[model samples]
Target: MSSAHITFDTTGDKIARRVRKMRSSAVRDLFAAATRDDVISLSGGMPAVSLLPVEDVRAATLAAVESPEARAVSLQYGPTNGAPGLRAVLADMMRDLGIRVKPDQILVTTGAQEALSLIAEAFIDPGDIIITEGPTYLGALQAFSAFEPDVRAIPFDDEGMRMDLLEEELKRIGKGNPRLKYCYVIPNFQNPGGVTMVAERRRRLLELAREYDFMVVEDDPYGRLRYDGGHQVPLKAMDENVIYLGTISKMLGPGLRTGWIAAPESVLARINLVKQGADLCGSSFDQIIVEHYFKDIPWQKTLQKFVAVYKERRDTMLAALEEFFPPEATWTHPEGGMFLWITLPDYMDTDSMLAEALEAGVTYVPGNSFFPDGKTGRNSMRVNFSFETPESITEAIRRLAKVIEDRLELYRVFIEAGALPGYDRKEAAMTDEKTPTPWEEVVADSEQNEEAVMQAREGNAEQIDIAEEAVRDAQQAAAPAEEAAE
Candidate 1:
């Protein structure tokens, strides 16, 4: 809720209005469970860091500090923007994507995550509006929410963010509205929702940006990790003014934490000033290592190895989904991305099922993490293939499938007892209605059929091992979702 709309009573110290708007990353919260050996985590888009040879990593670090002069440069504080030679190397890398930018225009950020926060700080003010894909990146939402912008999410199809929908939204907001700031998009292999923005949508989006008078921010972290399919043209390649964010986090290694932003000099200048205050400068040590890694070695061959492994894992997950998931469930088959999205039945409520999933020995990010409201995408979840083995990926899907089936079976029990307003089990499963079953009514109705519900469960030998407690938890969790829909 916006602080402007209501006075939230704080217990002790007053929290900043901007801080109150901030949201924690849900994926980060899953790490505790992900660390457990018993759980198969399909939560993070973690790169396969194991694919890189240990010797290569050691060589990169040693090369960065090979001599006294190199050590001095690596350890000491460097330029606020970045080391010029490092920026030059990043520029040459960008050239591969058909983007031309001078090293002077590129501002090296701690990581693309820092670039996200810096952009928000520089451009967004309270009540300002920014556009993103309907289910955009969770990290980006966390960064933007701190500034309290009205994040308008435009829905996307397989080709990507619907330009027609964007046009309609723009008209509704009015052309040249000063409140409308910039549009943020991950053009290739988008996070959470693994659909790429097609070339036609790209051209139309840029054209609309000019007509509407707002800048475009392109965050391309997954562009280089393509498993198969040809690359789509980057937004920055078409427009010189677009703010382009790139990183070595996916390719070289996330531990390096190095990324850069290329924008118009005016915009870069403002962000550079903001960056200096955030951290004196990003680790000069990390920057030195990144420079040596990309500039000194054959990085492309290692990236191909990463791609091949990801492709096999992706195939494994896809086959598992087809074999195990229910008919009511559907998923995205991405051409080249680390994660795929699974959308369950309208009433399945993925957020409400997370507890059950944890108990089932697999963890996934409920789709609510991707949206600003945190409750709108309750029927979907994001699954990752880049972090786990092919065997683990297959087993994780099987476990996840059981969780979905358990929920569906519970709903069927309610319908059978006249607790839910559906004709039968098949009708209820296929229903497109958004309204959830009434909690109070279902509880009241369940008393009379408690014996029958239990009996039905005991008779089904193949049912997932969802205990009474798990079933109750799922049903109770829906109350808040019911309120959100209202």
Candidate 2:
């Protein structure tokens, strides 16, 4: 068959400019790669659906779908304000968080993703300033980018975003930009970096927002998934002015696509306008399912199941990190949530390392995609511990550590020759002083180059060898008999 020549319009300046300027999000593309079965993905902030209360949800949904009343809500159109029963339950849940919001203040959206987009559509004008953490939620960044907001990023430390830096940025913006709409934060159990903001910092942040006369958009989907200890109150609990975002995607399941935003009545009104224009309203069927799921089913039991399962996964990831990462790497210890942040030496780039790690048979989200300003965090990566089995976490972390060690060694050579200035020198310095190894550093580098590491087995590498032996045994058992025999 002769090929048909296709003609395309390439002359329209506006369309060409728009097409050239707009690009698909890096995170979205990364998610596509994460779906590969061969890829041990520590990327994408995905909850382990294997642990979801699926059976209960399914049963609740079946009951709801079977009921004549449920059939009407499920089959017919739903209110833009969401199902009244669901709204009432959500309002009560909000009250538990110390927000005395009524059901009228709630807007149910498809997901927190839709909630963010609606909020941006309602509040963010072109050229308006919206501050975010240095490494914030990629989904939020993508959602706000559509509105052409001038996004500003403030650096964050372990305690969360430095209030001093935020205050300084606020003052600087005040000098020129008074059209600051809001500051977005994931104060409890943040995505990509599982650091929780201290309660005092939450208070200080609200104080800053009040002083600056700006809104605080608190996106909290992971707070309810805490594994290790006493629960921390959400930042929204501390401020009546805060716009609170909550999702069942993590707790129940993402397939439900159910999430709600608790905001001031004025903001809720605006959000409703934007939301109505978007999807009309979230799934009426899903809203009814959620309500019945909460009412008829024992939600407390389901939540407990999630807590117990995810806590095990979290511990597994921590143990794997201790067994595989290089000595020069450091990672966050999350109290709750699916992600943990890893910071490599300055000379390492996580984007480059991602290619190498994937080639070596693992995957992680590069840190650059999370930055609103796209300025720093290149030498970092975000790993999700909630999706894969403990075995997968171990293998992924091990491969990643090898990649990091090789990169660091290459950088060390350049540094020794004075070609790289910012490379870490403390590794050599500590040896010169014969200082005791930091337990933290040891935990970071458990997956150094196996050959070189074997030689240094006298220096804590022995423990790694023992773990490797166990992995070998496990792999051997799973291998085909013919291959195993060979």
Candidate 3:
């Protein structure tokens, strides 16, 4: 065959439909820009790996490889369900959290990422309804998107997912509807929003699950990382209907890529079958190393240390926000976890302002991506405090504040000049006492300058000219009043 006839565009047509729908992770994309020495990144759900107990990890690795029996298991292929010892260790850990599960109930995967994927694979079907918090974890949204589920996001408050709103939605969907597959939640230190579910809400959620006859995927990667708060029990602890996801990524390091799912054996069996097709099994050596670390090291002490370091960073960021940010800006005060959400004025779009923020030497994941439907959260962004140092975070917040102030001022000018399309004068007057100049008045006063105003609106001429002319006219109009008072 001729070369032209044989040539193929693999990405153009050969790619799977699901793969084509996958969008690049916003946090991952920001990593490249964040690497610059001058840039302070409050992006990415990254833990401070530098603070991890280096000696303990080194010792664990040695024990896993140096011993003959351990070496054989580490190097060889293992069971698809995960190594026995690791499951037992995790079971014991879960017991501490009040979740009673046997080793057989657990299905180990590459990481929490893969566990999410496996769950999505086993349960999600096209057009199935999957409920999540309004500003939920982006990674989970990405995972479920491949399966083409109808993702419905419910708004959350400081206490977490509004059960009242959930009940309303559930009522709409009707009780015991098979089309409703599952509800995914980050109960402890939820991603992006950083709001933990309160005990009352947790109980109500289980009750809803029971009434609605659906599953709850409880993602608890950050549950143990609480810095300052009373410990809230995981939903799985209260009920077995929850499919619990646990990870060593936040606690130890993400490099291990080890995570587990504690679910009913029936569900786990289905997940195991899907996992077999996905990757067969997780890394044998890494699982063994984690098992060793849990057995030999004071893991609880390590968790305490992580809390101390991250709590300082979180506090620093919060204090800096209070000192530097505009009064209109508001943010979540998370008790624990890597992220806190900030909401800017409704007129501000974080997505549009990202380039300016990056130019100002800081980066954040714009909040819109966290919403599955992408219809809201335009005025918000998720700020991560776990990766950067306190000094870096402080400086980053300062830069971000400047960007917000500049953007807000520009937006105000646009609205006042009637340069912005669909500007509502009545709404502006009600919200702020500074009444917006009528477009007709602006036009009537500047009849000779009509060409300039039109040019400014069309981007054919400088906007500064229009703003300056309006300011000058307003000042000139006020001069007589000031003289009369004198």
Candidate 4:
């Protein structure tokens, strides 16, 4: 007798509930678009790896593996926390950032990315409340999301996350909320936003963390790469309650995948337990290479080179934006770090315009993805300056500007035709709301209005003529008002 053929269908039922809720990274999607030869990408917080000290790295690799003793150590399984020597080195590095921690307190992970994941695993449970800056690091959002945390995003300004708003949120969360996990922040040259937390605010943040009995995770991947202005002390420097994360990805090559978490030993112990079940340990070989590089090579010189090259690229992008962007567009002038934020006219949705931007030979990460709730920053984008050369950066900005100009012109037409009621460029620019009308709705309204106008023109010439005359008068009347508002 022939056995009956059997097949099992494992659709959504087999997937974890948390995994089902996770969204794909918008920056990764833009990065894929950028892989095309014709598209220039200002997405992804990628360092200028071309500027890395290749000769030094090569030498370090050789030194790390030449001896039989060294090879054995690298090849063998190591401590879950990290290699002791590298942890010591990382401890010294943290001291330079004003964080005093023993080597035992440092938990070296695969990279800062894994460090973030470990923190989430150690601290967060389902339905826990995790606070972060509005438009915070997308990767951090992805990391915390896996634990099913309720992320509360507080808005930020040029200085950084607004303390007033954060304080109010904490009070609302209440001091007795056991589900409140921690406040995760990229305090130095924060990803996407590129706003540094001021020292006074940093102190206040520590004070609040203590009073509220919540930990503060200070992710400081870009702190040392300052191109201008004095350095602000890290949050960890002032408070032992702060958990500091540092990575060699920006300083050295990201391929090495070396990063460390400097926190209290008790916290490190808990994270190490979670980490063992995740990957057991990071690449033992990579940690050794990082150790040799830090010990033998002039890492500070490499950092200086990165700052010089990246600063030039940043300046080029800024200058190009000034010359090519529409009058209604505004962007941040970041002192350092890979990214700068741009805010377009409110009605313009960067996510909707991304297709047009790629068609125009440029790409950017839509700003909505950076938010915890993905509700705000519809009219914004994050642009990276470190990955592209100055010439390419200029050309990319010029291409992006054309797309913006075309979109803005379309919006103007809709306004002139009275399709968008009570919506003027000036009024839209001044208001800040948590939710705006979705771009699809706006486009649908415009299309319906345009069809109505076309039907009127074809069926009744007299009515069409009157409508055109009235539109002309409206445009003429609004010209002076727009100019006065400007």
Whole-model Cα lDDT per candidate?
0.85, 0.77, 0.87, 0.85
**Candidate 2: worst-modelled 10 consecutive residues by lDDT:** 442-451
Q: What is the C-alpha local distance difference test score of candidate 4?
A: 0.85
> What are the RMSD figures for all models against the true structure?
9.5, 10.9, 5.7, 5.9
Q: Which sequence of candidate numbers ranks them by lDDT, best first?
A: 3, 1, 4, 2
lDDT of predicted model 2: 0.77
Q: Candidate 1 at 379: error in angstroms?
A: 0.6
Model 4 spans > 4 angstroms off: 1-9, 424-470, 473-486
RMSD of 1: 9.5
Output the TM-score of candidate 4. 0.88
Question: Higher-TM-score candidate among 1 and 4?
Answer: 4
* Per-residue lDDT of candidate 3, residues 1-486 (tens digit): 566656657668778898888877888899999999889988888899888778998999998889799889999999999999999999999998889999999999899999999999999999999999999999998899999999999999999999999999999999879899999999988998988999999999999998999999999999888888699988998888689999999988899999999999999999999999999899999999999899889988888889999999999999999999987678899999999999875556688679989999999999898998764787799999999999999999999999998766655565566655555644556654333233332223222243343344456546766776775776688699989999
lDDT of 1 by residue, 1-486 (tens): 665775666653677878866777888999999999899999988998989978778888997799999899999998989988899999999999999999999999989999999999999998999999989999999999989999999888889999999999999989879999999998888898888999999999999999998889999999988876788889999999999999998898888989899998999999988998999688889998898888988999999899899999999999999899877677888888799888865555787678889999999999989988887777789999998999999999999999889877865655544444333434454556444333332333332344444444467533323444444666687679989999
- Mind sharing the TM-score for model 2? 0.84
Tell me how many residue pairs clash in candidate 3.
0
**Residue 60 displacement in candidate 3 (angstroms):** 0.5
lDDT of model 3 at position 471: 56
The number of the candidate with the highest lDDT is 3
Evaluate candidate 2 by giving its C-alpha RMSD to the native, one decimal: 10.9
